[model samples]
Target: MKILITGGAGFIGSHFAVKMLKEQHEIAIIDNLHPYYSVDRKKQHLEVIKEAGDFQFYQTNLLDRDETINIIKEISPEAIVHLAALPGVAYSILRPLEYIDYDVKATVNVLEGAGMAGVKQVIFASSSSVYGMMKNVPFREEMAAGKPISPYAASKYAAESFCHVYGHLYGMNVKILRFFTVYGPWGRPDMAIANFIKKLKNNEEITIFGQGGSRDYTYVGDIVNGMGLALKNLKQSAIINIGSGRPISMDQLLDELRVYYPDMKIRTEKNRAGDVDRTWADISLARELLDYEPEVDFSKGIAETVAWAEQHEDFL
Candidate 1:
């Protein structure tokens, strides 16, 4: 299969690209290399992807509708894994409009381009944030995601609506995967695990928010595996969650970190805006539909992530 992965130089995108390349699939990546974090880091990711296998890399921003459409038409990929977006819930609170511009508009442009090119399938990466503070413990796909607390979540939900619209109009198969709290090697620096490690390494105090809220911390490998399965078996449009189905509290996360940082310091603060009390994904739908099961244990994943971060000190 010829696959076009947008934002293929980012953390999860790079992992997925490597997986596809190794599977002998022809891959093309579209990335703006936006300095949301570090262009140098993204370049490093591209280098790693190159080492995995040969692939076409297009430095195109999805925000440019004309260019995005033209590139898709030129590639004419059988499938598109749309992963480009400005990610960060807290950051979204500060600049909500940026989410509309980068997350919502970019996704619309991708769908538009895919529709124009008659692409067969589109796999959109949504977030657990869309669930908001549901009364239920484990969030299900059937649950209404109408009250997104953050602009980032709202934008993702809005983009998902566009996906269904495009799917209905163009007869394209769309798979929306709402990923849980994803963490792993080559992880984003802004994420909690990475932030804790960075702060600990620098002898700085790490702050715990909102009585140590829990999250279904899914590993990137599992998330990528779920996506691969979705690509193969999903014959129609669906909204499914790709998560570990195991919720880990912040205190538990810190305890895991203590194994690495015995002398790490900590403090407490109120929950930040746009933050949820907990996120637990009911991945039974994924299990039933795609035979998806998370393989990496949380402790093992954290050990590997910490080890990787230690080697790549510059990544922090």
Candidate 2:
């Protein structure tokens, strides 16, 4: 199948691109290479992707409605995996308006383009942050995501709604996969795991916020597999979660890290605004729909991530 991946230069997007390419799917990528993180790292991801297989690369911003629509019309992919968005929860707190433009508006543009291009399916990459501070354990897709704590989360939720709109109006299959804390090789530098590893290597102190909340840290490989399954099995509009279904506190994560950085410096502080106490994804819906199961163990996933960060110390 021909697939178009937006933000295909970033962490999860890059991994997914390689996965699709390896599966012998025709691929086209659109990424503005936003400096929200290191452009060098994204470029490195692109290099790896190119080595995996041949694909069309377009450095186009999704915020440009006309250009994005034209690009989609030109590619006319059978499906679109929308992954581009402004990330960073705490950073979103500082510049909330940008979330509207980058996340919300950008998603609408993608959906608009997909609908206009007669795309058959759209797989939106949502986030667990949309679950907010819900007291429920193992969040379910049916749960109300109306109360997002961060602008980033709110934008994702809004984007999910627009995806449904396009699905309904355009007669397309839209699958909204809410990813739990994704981490692994080529992980985002701003993420907690990457930050801790980088700080440990730099002999700097790692800061833990609040009671050090837990997260269902899902592996990037598992995430890409889930997306592939969703693309194959989904026949209608649905919302599902792609996660490990395992929650680990910050202490547990640090304990795993201590295996490598036995003397890792640490400090504590109040939880930042828009931070959730814990996130645990109930992936039963995904199993029922796509037979999705997370294969990577948390300890092993962290080990791989640390190894990658160590190898790419300059990038980190």
Candidate 3:
């Protein structure tokens, strides 16, 4: 199957692209190589993808409607994986309009472009943050996501809505996957696990917010696998949570990290606004619908991530 993956140079997208390519799927990628992270890292991801074969790659922003539409028309992909977005909740707080422009508007453009091009299926990247501060222990797809605290979460929820509208209007097959905190090797440096590993390796102080908030740190490999499963079962419009369904507190994570890096140091700080205290996913729907189950546990995933960080210290 011919597949188009947006943001295919970023952390999760890059991993997914490599996995799909290894399965011998014809792949086309679109990424802007934004300054959000090291362009060198993005280039490295592209180099890895090139090893599979000379696949299609376009250095274009999703906001460019003409360019995006033209690319879709040319590729005529059987499936479209929309992973491009302005992702950081805190950053969105500082630049709400930028988040709106890239996360919300750009998503609409993808949906519209896909619809016009008669793309069969779309797998969107949503976030667990959209659940906000839910009293529920494990969040479900049916729960109200209208209480998104940050601009980033709001934009993602809006994009999910747009996907539904496109699905209903144009008979487009859409699958919305609300990803939990994904961490692993080749992870984004800005993410907590990666940043903490980097800081600890350098003997620098790592900040802990809210004295140990919790998250369901899903591994990138597991996520990409779940994405593949979701794509296979893309029969209709649906929203599914992709996670380990296990919650690990920050203190627990730090303790595990200390085991890996005995000299690791951390400083406590107040939790930032728009940040949730905890997040655990009810992945039963994902398992039932997409046959998706997380294969890597937290401890193993963190250890692998730490090993990768140690080997690639120069990149940090």
- For each candidate in turn, give its C-alpha RMSD to the true structure in angstroms: 0.8, 0.8, 0.9
lDDT of 1 by residue, 23-96 (tens): 99999999999898989999999999999999998998898999999999999999999999999999999999
Q: Write the per-residue lDDT of candidate 3 for residues 32-51, one digit (tens) a residue.
A: 99888899998988987888
Taking all chains together, each candidate's TM-score versus the true structure is 0.99, 0.99, 0.98
Clashing pairs in 1: none
Model 3, runs deviating above 4 Å: none
Q: Show the lowest summed lDDT stretch of 10 residues, model 3.
A: 46-55
TM-score for candidate 3:
0.98
lDDT of each: 0.93, 0.93, 0.91
lDDT of 1 at 105: 95
Candidate 2 lDDT, 88-203, residue by residue in tens = 89999999999999999999999999999999999999999998998878799888549999999999999999998989989999999999989999889899998888899888
Clashing pairs in 3: none
Per-residue lDDT, model 1, residue 50, is 96
